[model samples]
Target: MLPNVTVNPAAEKFMRRMVRFSGHGDGAGFRLTVSAGGCSGYSAEFTVEGAPLAGDEVLAVGDLKVFLPAESRLMLDGVTIDFSDTPTASGLTFFNPNAGACGCSSSSGTSAQPPGVAKVDISSIRRN
Candidate 1:
C-alpha cells in the first residue's frame, strides 16, 4: 500500500539536521501545503510545524513528521520528497510521478492543460 505522500531517507536526515540547528525541540516538523501559483499551475509550500493541524494527514519518516492537508492528498499521492546538499544547490526537491513542465515545484502535478485540451481556464490560474 503506497502512502498518500512519502518522504525519502535523505529528507528525514536533513530534517533531523535542521531541527538540531534551528534550536527547536523534538516536536518540530514540517507543514506541506499547496497554493495556486507556480509555473506548473500550483506551488508547494513548506513551513515549520509545532504541532499537527486539526485535520491533516501526518506521514512519519524516521523521526520526522510531514503534515499534509486533506485537499492536497490527491495531488501529492505517491510523491517522494528528497533532500540534496550539493555545493551549488542544497534543498528539498519533490519527485512527483504526475508532474508536468515543473520548473520548481507544483501541487497541480502538471502543466496547465491547454484551453483546447480541456475546459480549464488557464487564465483563471493566477501567477506569482
Candidate 2:
C-alpha cells in the first residue's frame, strides 16, 4: 500500500516558475529519485532531464516538467518540495510524511537495520 501525497501550493508555484525559466532556452523537466544515503538509508535526489523514462511520474507543472520514478513514488507519497531564499542561501526543501521519528538523526531507527525495530541511544548521540 502507498500513502497519500499532497503537493504544497508554494512548491507548485515554484515548479511553475522553473518550467517557464527552463523552457525558454535549453532546459527540460525535473527528475525525482530516491537513492541510498540518508538517515533512513535512502535519500531523495532531484535532477533536470529533457525527457522521462517509462513508469515515471510525469507531472506537468506549467511549463516545468516533473518526473518521479515508480519505485520512489511510494516513499514520496504526500511529499512537497518548496523553494526558499534566505540570507544564507536559497534552495529547494522536501517534506516527506513517511520519515521516521528523529529527523535524519544518525541514532534514529531510520538508518538502522530491521526497519524500525532497532533501538538507539539518544543520549549517546547528543554527547557526540
Candidate 3:
C-alpha cells in the first residue's frame, strides 16, 4: 500500500454510511485512478470495488478502505477525500494537492461541459 496517502475521518464516515447496504460478499471500498478524459489531459476516476486488485494499494483508515492503483500513486499523493454539507452541494469530494489546474462542469442536463481547472470559486462547490 502507499505509505503517504491519507483518509480523513469525515471521508471514512461517509464511506461507511454510503456502502453499508452494498451487498459485497467480501469487503467493499472505492478504487481511485486517473484516466485520459475531462477538460484536462487526465481525470480522476473512482469506483466501488469488492476488494483491491492485483496491483492496487489499499489505504485502510478507520473501517474505510481506499484502493489506489499503483499507476496513480504519484498524482494522488497528499490528496484528501472529504464530505461536506455545503448549501449548494454535498457529497464525497477529492482535494488533490498534486493537481496543477483542473475544472469540472457545474451545469446540468445536455449543457454540461467537461471538467477543467478554472479560477471560479463556487462557494458551494468542491474542486480537485
Best by TM-score: 1
Better of 1 and 2 by lDDT: 1
Collision count for each candidate, in order: 0, 2, 5
Candidate 2 residues lying further than 4 Å off, grouped into runs, are: 1-3, 23-28, 40-42, 60-64, 103-128
How accurate locally, in lDDT, is each candidate? 0.56, 0.53, 0.57
Query: What is the alpha-carbon RMSD of candidate 3 to the true structure?
Result: 7.5
TM-score of each: 0.61, 0.56, 0.60
Indicate the residue-level lDDT of 60 in model 2: 59
* Candidate 3: segments with Cα more than 4 A from true spot: 1-3, 35-42, 97-128
Model 1, 42-94: lDDT tens digits are 45656666777888777776667766777666556666667655544456655
Best-to-worst order by TM-score is: 1, 3, 2
**Per-residue lDDT of candidate 2, residues 13-124 (tens digit):** 6555554555434446666665445454446555556677777767655555677787767665666555555564444555554556445445634333333222112121
What local lDDT does model 1 show for residue 18? 54
Error of 2 at 69 (Å): 1.1
Clashing pairs in 2: 5-78, 19-64
How much does each candidate deviate from the true structure in C-alpha RMSD? 9.2, 10.2, 7.5
Scored against the true structure, residue 19 in model 2 reaches a CA lDDT of 48
Pairs with steric clashes in candidate 1: none
